[model samples]
Target: MDHALIEASLGELTAANSRELERKCEQIALSYIAQLVEPQFDVDSADFARDPRLICADRYWNLRFQAAPTLATAVDCAGWMAEHVVAAVQDPIREKWAMGYAFITRNSVESAAEIADATADVVAADDSACNKAYFAALYHAGKLRANFFYDELEIFLAASPLALAAGPHRESVLFTALRAFAAFGSRTTVHQHGCALLDQMWNSAERTFAATDVVLNGLAAGKDFDGRAQLLRDRSAEAVAAYPGRDILHFRLATGRWMCGEYDAAMADIDEALRLLPAIGWRVSHELLQGQYLARRDAIEAARAADRQARIDRDRVQSTEREVDRLAGEVRGTVLRAVELVTVFAAVIAFAVGSLNVSLNGNITLADRIWIVVTQGVGLLLFAFLILGGSWFIADRLARRSERRDRPED
Candidate 1:
């Protein structure tokens, strides 16, 4: 548990030198694995893979789970996101919640409902407290209801005449008016129904757009943060156009613009948004947004600097390694020359010994000499193979380790 020990263990995992080192490295890896086992973190395995094909961000995917514009694309995108979510959720009960969510996103509401029911059955089967799961489900259901609610109202409003003199259903007028009670000072009555319904629909859309703006603004302000941001952008843009001069609407548009890489426009909108936010007390969210925006910009700059340094380090390492290899090759040549001299001297001594007792040497037999020759040849071949194999393995491992070290984290 010592901090230095853990740090050293992590270092070994990155550059292990022996089997024992590797075993220790594996133990260090398990420490991180233990973190994954915690239910809250929901770490996804596939997402950690080097190359994850990502679907381009779309607004609807944040919602009542609208499909991508094309059928095939929707399947591909939703499936990828679902896989990541499932991998992230380790708990069986919670994992199913993730699955239900992914299914709802890719399929029809009926299909989504079936998935949700199945997820509930799985949770119930465990006989565990699923109060959290139940609440999560309820909250999402409410959002989904809200998402569709305005769409329905919009349709109803379209059919209704501008003036009540045209005559629509009393029930529709009554319900719409009830929903609008807070927005417009008075409820819609048959007597003053003409303009009230239209006002109600506009007010409803404006409120929906405002709520959407908060969520999206939070998301856009965070680097690599996805979800609801695009939806906020689309909905708030519409709201701004529909209800001009609601300063926050313009602010939301500018924030969305900033998130999408339109920095100039975003600055313009933030200028306006800041002026209006004082009254609404939305400065906290705006402050967080500005902080995140600055942080990401700083991160980008830091990453570029780190990348340049890594390239320089890699070049220096390769140059040093080449120098060492060249020196080693020169030394190898000197060793070969020394070995050749020794072999020549040994052969001379053997020949001289044989000549002193030619018949006795003949009696010693050609097979003996051939045996000596064969043993030397085999020994030399074995030595060569061992040297080459060991060097190759060590060099390959070092090269791979160096490459990994030199690679940028992001």
Candidate 2:
């Protein structure tokens, strides 16, 4: 029961269609029976009645072609089918997932729930294979939990003797793969939520086993739920006592500390895990957790930058407004002063020509005529300058207003 081997097999099963995966499962189980310890008891025809996989497969195959594959219809068919298979066989979890895959692809959450519920009970009853399937079912439940009628998934963390004896070295790998699958779904809004639960369940399971390098790395990176990080730290201490100079549990313990928001402790764990990870291919879970840590760090930095920019923009706007007000006030005073000067000049020119009767007679000297003419000419030029200056000021103001109106709001 190498968790890694089973994980690889499950990967094949997941990617394959229902029928194909089922066939592969049957072949593997049969091969294991053939090669492993020989059977002592007889498998009777009546015992076949107790064998549920055969019964389930027979029933589901018929249901597939008969109906339009509604959620209810799929469940009804798959439930009865899976029960019979598990009842007759010692471990039918893998076969059940294959059945679930069929129903899931057809959008039958009910059928998957039926099998998942059954698998949970087996896990509680101490079936090692059931534990694996329980996590798998949790993932399916998350993926297809929309229907209220579907049963809820319950994850059992206690160790079973059958499971402990089956694959001492491999369960972690299985845990890793299933967790990745569950996480893949949970990453999206529309997918499964069983990922975190599965991670928790496996973390509990890992505590009962001998600590390995891969397991330690996962713990150090905080791959499990928050509550379990402390447990991993304690477990890592045990690993150190049993296998001194090993980097496996030390890194995991550090990761647990990190996940618990102890950055300094996490850094220490990372340093140790890095020392050991090179011995084995770095675990995928550790890599993903590292990515998550980096992503959060980036998000925090971005938020700080945005806050700083907002303050700068606010100050700039206030300064610009004050400058505009000061310029507007100066322009207004200058315009009013110009109007008053033009009025005074007009009155003076009229008084000189009319009331004073200062005439430039044709028989008078040229210097007198030139002085009178120059005075009138200067008055005319000053009036024209005032008129053009006012027009230019109005035009410039309108142009600025138009530009502001055309600009996009922030």
What are the Cα lDDT values of the candidates?
A: 0.40, 0.44
Off by over 4 Å in 2: 1-120, 124-127, 130-132, 147-357, 360-369, 407-410
Top lDDT model:
2
Candidate 1: residue 292 lDDT (0-100): 45
| lDDT tens readout by residue for model 2, 1-410 | 35346435644554555556555645544443445421122221222122323322333333342333332333333343334334354233333332333333434433544554544444454334433443344334333322211222112112322223224322443334333333333323222243343345445633323213333433333234535557556656666676565444555555455545555555555565556543221123335444544454444345446656887997798678667766775676677577667666775666466424545365656777677667776766677677657756875786577457545599
lDDT of 1 by residue, 178-282 (tens): 223212221222212323443444455323333333333333332232433454456557767765665556766765664455555556665665565433211
lDDT of 2 at 347: 56
TM-score of each: 0.27, 0.28
**Superposition error at 225 for model 2 (Å):** 24
The positional error of residue 49 in candidate 1, measured at the CA in angstroms, is: 57
Candidate 1 Cα RMSD (Å): 29.0
Local distance difference test, candidate 1: 0.40
